[model samples]
Target: MSVDTFAPCIFRMRQTYVTDVVRMHLEIFIQPK
Candidate 1:
């Protein structure tokens, strides 16, 4: 694959992974102890 196309693919994957992590952290913090 070309670098131009691959760069965006990697960025999107990283963005999604970060979003999932943030969501998990939010859920954990919002829960009562």
Candidate 2:
């Protein structure tokens, strides 16, 4: 795999993980109120 394709693939996975964590945290914060 070339850097052109590989770098984006890695970035997408990280982005997905960060998005999921942010969403989960939002839900948890809402539950407290």
Q: How many clashes show up per model?
A: 0, 0
Tell me the whole-model lDDT of each prediction, alpha carbons only: 0.98, 0.98
Please list the residue runs of candidate 2 whose C-alpha ends up more than 4 Å from where it truly belongs after superposition: none
For residues 1-33, what per-residue lDDT tens digits would candidate 2 score against the true structure? 999999999999999999999999999999989
lDDT of 1: 0.98
Q: Compute the lDDT for candidate 2.
A: 0.98
Report the C-alpha lDDT of model 1 over 7-33, residue by residue, as the tens digit.
Answer: 999999999999999999999999977
lDDT for residue 13 in candidate 1, whole number 0-100: 100
Please give me the total number of clashing residue pairs in predicted model 2.
0
What local lDDT score does residue 6 receive in model 2, on the 0 to 100 scale?
Answer: 100
Q: Give per-model TM-scores.
A: 0.87, 0.78
